[model samples]
Target: MSAAIWLGRFLFALVWGALLANLVWPFPGKGFALFLILLFVLLAIHLLQLLMFASAYRHFVQWRRGDYWQIVVFGIVGWFAILNAQPQREQELKR
Candidate 1:
């Protein structure tokens, strides 16, 4: 994996960790509320990305549960990893 992807994954992990921590020990004030709203918005966007990816690749790629989860968590970075991991033939077919 490239440094950029690793960095993106790390930042995503931190965001997810913070959200999990907030769930266990709720933060005080309106700022936290705004954060929750932002988080939900992000989740919605990721879900949409997942759907688009699945629809676009369903025929050529073998879908897996882990792939879905990764895309959901990592968003575009996950898409990048998946595309780059594909064999050259598959990649060409996608064009």
Candidate 2:
């Protein structure tokens, strides 16, 4: 996946991790109830985000099928690959 996509996944994982940790961290008492509520809320938000992701993927796939996104995706991927590959290239050149 793209860097942005990977980073987004990392951040989302952090969110989920925090939510789960909240239940146990900072003591376990009345906050547990609040945490339960928060967990449910997070679940709802997570579901919505998943739906949105699915919807976006569906549209993107459709666009790809039409060849409308090929250039854009290629350019973005090329840009990221080149930018990130520079350090490796320098190392290889040194070797």
Candidate 3:
């Protein structure tokens, strides 16, 4: 994987880890509220990305459960990774 993708995955893991930590120990006041807002916003953006690309994905790719999870966590970067990983023949078929 590229460094950018690895960085994105690292950041996503940090955010998820923070949320999980908050659930266990909890953050105080505005911090907790902010974390919740961040979580929801991220989820909404990821969901929109998935929906926007759903048709193209269904047509051109054979996706697994992990692919969906990657999209959820890494968003558009994940989508592009999947696209770039496709065989050259499959990519040409889109043209």
Candidate 4:
């Protein structure tokens, strides 16, 4: 689970780095709409992932965290994002 969370975060970091690169690159001035769109969508997914993880983090009793309700909300939203982003897979062992 931590791997999934970290992978998601890493993707977001890559996205940020790419945007910075794009900004630094002296271009012919043509806009890169496709890359921008992909980056935005990925960023959204990563955001949901972060929310889900943060929600889980709030459960640590030692942390004395607040707002358990918000965590549930974030988990729900993250699930939605994952469902939308994931490609359909064949059920190898449907019960």
Compare the candidates by lDDT and give the number of the best one.
Answer: 1
Clash list (residue pairs), candidate 1: none
TM-score of each: 0.80, 0.40, 0.76, 0.38
lDDT of 3 by residue, 15-79 (tens): 87897776677799888888878878888999888877776668768665677877887898888
Give the residue spans of candidate 4 off by over 4 A. 1-15, 24-31, 61-95
- Compared with the true structure, the alpha-carbon lDDT of candidate 1 equals 0.82
State the displacement of the C-alpha of residue 75, model 1, in Å, after optimal TM-score superposition.
Answer: 0.4
lDDT of 1 by residue, 15-66 (tens): 8888767767778987678678878987999999999999998887766578
RMSD of each: 4.1, 11.5, 4.0, 12.0
- In model 1, the runs with Cα more than 4 Å from the true position are 88-95
lDDT of each: 0.82, 0.51, 0.77, 0.47
lDDT order of candidates, top first: 1, 3, 2, 4
lDDT of 3: 0.77
Best by TM-score: 1
TM-score of model 4 vs. true structure? 0.38
Supply candidate 2's per-residue lDDT for 79: 34
List of clashing residue pairs for candidate 4: none
Task: Report the C-alpha displacement of residue 47, candidate 2, in angstroms.
Answer: 1.0
Q: After superposition, how far is residue 2 of candidate 2 from its true place, in Å?
A: 7.4
